[model samples]
Target: MIGALLIILFSTKDVWAPDNINGLILLYNGDIETGSIVRVEEYNLLAYAIQTTLTQTVLEI
Candidate 1:
């Protein structure tokens, strides 16, 4: 959905700085205090977010 599209659009290497695009994906969906922080590349973050989104959509069906 929108989140996936945003991830793909922002993931373009030539258009965006990887350092500036760094972010955290809440592993538990909420309750951030319990989640662990792991360093990852920008592309990896985008891929992981897209994958998680798609998986959730599929599971919802």
Candidate 2:
């Protein structure tokens, strides 16, 4: 019973990994992006792209 529970617990990590949606970003150019928001500055917003594994900054929006 304990071993089965452990297996189930570990498997859930993989299943929930992709479901992590930090937030949404709406750009002024009419493009939408979903990722983990890094920072919000005066003139720009920075976020870590989930699909690309990189940081993106939007100056207009």
**Top model by TM-score, which number?**
2
- What does the lDDT come to for candidate 2? 0.49
Write one digit per residue (lDDT tens) for candidate 2, span 1-61.
Answer: 9999999988896665443432122343324455545556874766564443223333332
15-60, model 1: which lDDT tens digit per residue? 5554333322333453123222333475354211222221131111
* CA lDDT, every model vs. true structure: 0.37, 0.49
Query: Which residue pairs collide in model 1, if any?
Result: none
TM-score for each model = 0.22, 0.24
**TM-score, cand. 1 vs. native:** 0.22
- For candidate 2, the TM-score is 0.24
